[model samples]
Target: MRYLPIDNQLFVQNRQRLAPLLKSKSLVVVNANDIMPTNADGTMVFRQNNDLFYLTGVDQEETRLVLFPEHPDPKFREVLFLRETSELIEIWEGHKLTKAEAEQVTGIPQKQIYWTHQFEQIFGQMVFEAEFIYLNTNEHTRAGVEVQTRDARYIDAFRQKYPLHHLERLAPLMHYLRAIKQPQELPLIQTAIDITDKMFRRLLGFIKPGVWEYEIEAEMMHEFLRNRSRGAAYTPIIASGANACVLHYIDNSQQCQDGDVILLDIGAEYANYNADMTRSIPVNGRFTARQRAVYDAVLRVMKEATQMLRPGNLWDEYHREVGKVMESELIGLGLLDRTEVANQDPDAPLYKKYFMHGTSHFLGLDVHDVGNKYRRMEPGMVFTVEPGIYIREEKLGIRLENNVLITESGNIDLMANIPLEADEIEEMMN
Candidate 1:
């Protein structure tokens, strides 16, 4: 791993917390994500399953975690199966985790560590003893699963093997546990945000008219890679001019124009934890009068929306309130009038024309991280406060974002040190 080693206590505590939530006599199983295949003989870089990583800091392929708290044998209760290393394998693919190394990294006893080949025999015994089996699968609200994952394959095979064993979805329990950030996880996220901050600041000096949008993206990747980030948490969106009006613009093929604005929706990932940030800047380092108005409107909305991210606030209600704030700012910017807003359908506000996407989303292991949106906000929850206005007709788009942690007292902006104010951005650029 390019990132530094994390303390194992975080994973230990995560397992301890999740154990109580499962049904009695349950056998919990989480498999690592498969090393995905590409064109012939090639494979994409491996990414560990977030749940598997959360439960046991093992970031490798063909790994499995079994949590059978009620097992007759204490040693079998919490077993971690790793792909055993060999001389030939080492020569071909480098060294894999040793038993002692895995034990130290995961805080599991050395005796409980075993080779992946032993999983079928050990898991079979546990399945016979346990009444329920908890299986992990991707259940993110926005997930579109076209490819069959390792977990999916396991579910199909396991059902055929033991049809009588009561199966339960582990996603809900995992989601609930992961929703609240543990104290140790905060530093990893902060590290990612800090890397992103460095990249953004570097771009300020590099961005100018005549530069290609991809050039700006390359600068971001360069900074992130040097600062221990595994490239972007997601595909970096380097949208310039009218391209910025497209929400998911990532073509990054056009040259930046002097009067145009660039919407950079990018982030850095450190130790698997992610930071989601978006910032809009003038291509020529100075916002025109009209551009400044739209930018300020979005900035005001972003600030007001951030303040509403405190504990006890409901997500839907908070977004509705943010919409009202945005509506007012849009009116002030002459994008929408009082009469238009008054007659507009409450369910489908006229503001959708200029400002469409949600103002905030949970940010963590995944860029659009998982958390129950219907539930009220709580302390330890981190969200990205991104509000924007896209004026396609005027070829102007402005978005300002920061990662914020919800606290009991209020909220803490993780990107607070990064430039946000128009004057500050202008000053930095100049």
Candidate 2:
């Protein structure tokens, strides 16, 4: 791994907390993500399964984590099955983890090194002993199909082998635990944000009338790589002008124009933790008065929404409150009439016509990080406060986002150093 090692205590505590949630005599299993293939001999870069990484801190492929808290043998309680490295693999792909190394990295004392071929025999032995199995799967609402994942294949095979055992979904428990960032995870996310801030500042001088959108993406990548990040946390949306209206716009091919605004929703990933940041700024040195009005309104709504992210606040209620805040901002921007809002459908508000997406989501491991929307805010919970107004007809989209960590007092803005105010942004650009 290019990134520095994360403290194993984070993973240890994560497993400790989750162990009680499992049924007695049950074993919890987590598999690393498949090193997905493209065409021919080509393959996409490997991304470790967030759940597997969360539990074991093992970032390699063909690795499996078995947590049998109720095992008769203490060594079997938490076993890490790794891809036993061979001389050939070392010559080609460099060294894979040794048993001692995996133990050190994960702080799980018991390690059973195995090849991919031995998985069935080893796993089958555990299945016969356990009454229930906690199988990990991607249950995130935003997850969409593209290719078959390792977890998906594991489920199909596991059911065929042990159809009688009660299979429980591990995603819900993982979503709950991973959503709440541990103290050790916070610094890694902060490092990502710091790198992202540096990249954004670099773009201020680099972005101008003639720069292509992809060039901006390249600039951010340069900064990320230099700062020890894997790269952009997600596909960067370097949308300029009308393209900003497309929420997931990532073509990044168009040339930025003088009067146009570029919506940049990008962040760097340090360790496995991520930072999701969005900033819309003028291509020129300054925002037009009209643009400034809408930008500031979105900024105001973002600031207010962040304040509501303290402990005990429900995620759904917080979003509803954010909608009202956005409704007011839209009304202030003349996009909504006060009377219209009063008469609008409760299910589909007038504000949706202009400001479409939700104001925030849990931010951490994944960009749209893992958290139940139904879950109440806790002090350790981290989220993104991103509220925007996109008017395709007007060819304008303004979004300002920052990472906020819930605290005892209220919440701390992790991206507090990143320039957000219109004056600060413009001054940085100039």
Candidate 3:
């Protein structure tokens, strides 16, 4: 792990909160993410499962966590199963976590920590004793599961072995627990945002006409790596010119012309927490009058949208209110007229023509972190306020984004120190 070690008390507190939520005589199992394969002999870098990491702070592969809080045997109440290391394996893959180290990192007693080889015997005994099984899987609403994960495979096998046990989805409980940020998690998230701030500031000086989009992306990667980030939270989108109008454009093949605007939707991940940010800047270090108009409109909408991220705000209602603000901005930008907006269908707003996509999404472990969209906003919930105007005909796209934390008083902008004003960006670049 490139990031520094986190205090294990966070994980200990997380487990303590989760244990009481499970059914009586229940056993919860969470598996680490598989080291994904690319080709015959190649594999992608391994990433720990968020739930497992949140619960145990264990960041290695082939690891499992078993929580049987109601077990008669106190030693088995909270167990950590790790892949046993050997001379050959250590030589090939470097050092894996030792038993004592795992115990220290996870706050579990050494007696409760076991090797992967002993998992079946121990888990089998616990399964027989428990009436309910809580299994973990990727249940994010936007998840597209093309490949089967390790946890998915385990779910299949566990069902076949213990069909009589009542199986429950652990995702709901996990999502509920993860939605509200713990006080300790704020520092980690703020660290990630600060890293992103550094990268964005660096790009202000690096971006110029005649530079390729991929080159700008390289600069971002360099900055993130030097600051202990695990590269981008997602694929870094460095779209220039008309490409910015395409929401997910990542080709990054075109050279930025003098009059073009580059849309950079990038972030840095630290300690498994993610920061999602988007900033659009001019290729020539200064926005043209027309570009400034669209940019300012997006910025206005972004500021107003951020203010609506207070506690008790409903996700759906908050978005609807933002849409009204965006509508007025689009009309001011001459993209939509009052008559057109008035005649537009209630189901499909006319503002979407210029301003598409949601104004905000939950930001945390995953880029688009999980939370109940229907639930009212609560203090400690973090969201990304990104508002944009994509004018394909004009070959211009402008977006301004910042991470905001909902508070009792209002919302606090995490990216408050980052430059957002047109003059500030231009001055930095100059």
Candidate 4:
């Protein structure tokens, strides 16, 4: 792992929280993500499944965690299975976790840890004792994964092996638990945001009228690596000028022009926790009057949305309020007529022409972290407040984003120290 080790207490506490939510005699299973293959004899980088990591603090492949809180035997109540290592395998792929190492890393009892090959026999004995089987899967509302996951394969195998066993979805339970950050998780996220802040400061001094968009991307990668981040939390959007108006623009092939603005949507990933941030800067280190105006408007919306990410706030209602705020700003910018806005189809707000996306989304383990949108915001929940104004006709787009943490009293902006104001960014660039 590129990131530092996280305390196993966090996972212990997470399992404790989940145990009570499960029905009696239920056995929860979480599998590590498969190491995906690319082309001939090539494989993509391995990323441990977030849910598996959350439950066991084991960031390795071919691993499984089973939680049977009501098991007749204490050892089987919480067991971890690891891939058995061989001399040839060790030489080929470095060290796999030893039984003792797994116990130390995951807080699992060493005696309870067994090799992956023994799972069939051990799990067979445990499954018959449990009345219900809970299996994990990617249930993110926006997820569109085409490839089957290790968990999916396990689900198929279990169904065929025990056709009469009552199976249950574990995603909702996981989403509910992972949505709120634990005390230990906050520092990891803060570290990611801190790394991104340093990179942005460095980037300000490097951006010039002639620099290629890819050059800026290179700078971002360099900073992230040195700071121990595992690159960007998601694919970065390094869009310049008209490219910025294409919401998810990632083709950073164009050259920056003196008067054009570049929209940077990037963040660093640390220890599986993530940061999500966005900023729009002038190529020549000075925004045009129009650019500054649009930038300020988006900043205003971002700030307002950040404040709304507090306890008791519903996700759907919060976005609706942010839309109204954007509508007011668009009218002031002469992009929307007040009469036209008021008369526009309530189903489709007129402000969407300039600001089409939601003002905020849950942020943490994943860039778009998992949480029940309908559930009210609570303390320890982190969110990304991003508001943008895209004007394709004028070849301009302005977006401002920050990570926010909802606390008992109010909320804290994780990226507050990072440059956000147009004047501050301009000053730093100059």
True-structure RMSD, every candidate: 0.8, 1.4, 0.9, 0.8
lDDT tens per residue, model 4, 338-417: 99997999889999889999888888889999999999999999999999999989999989889999999999999999
Worst 10 residues of 3 by lDDT: 121-130
The CA lDDT at 155 in model 2 is 86
lDDT of 1 by residue, 264-290 (tens): 999999999999889999988999999
Q: Which parts of model 4 have CA positions greater than 4 angstroms off?
A: none
Q: Write the per-residue lDDT of candidate 3 for residues 1-430, one digit (tens) a residue.
A: 7898888899999999999899999999999999999999999999899999999999999999999999998988898999999999999999999999997899998888999899998887777889899999888989999999999999999889888999999999999889989998889999999999999999999999999999998999999999999899889889998999999998889999998999999999999999888999998999999999999999999988988899888999999999999999888978888997999998999988888799999988878988899889999999999999999999998888899998889989999999999999899989
Q: Which is better, 1 or 2, measured by TM-score?
A: 1
Against the hidden true structure, what lDDT does model 1 obtain?
0.93
The per-candidate count of clashes, in order, stands at: 0, 0, 0, 0
lDDT for model 4, please. 0.92
The order by descending lDDT is 1, 4, 3, 2
Q: Which of the two, 2 or 4, has more lDDT?
A: 4
- The regions of model 1 sitting more than 4 angstroms off are none
TM-score, each model?
Answer: 0.99, 0.97, 0.99, 0.99
Residue range with the least summed lDDT across 10 consecutive positions in model 4? 1-10
What TM-score would candidate 2 get against the native? 0.97
lDDT of each: 0.93, 0.89, 0.92, 0.92
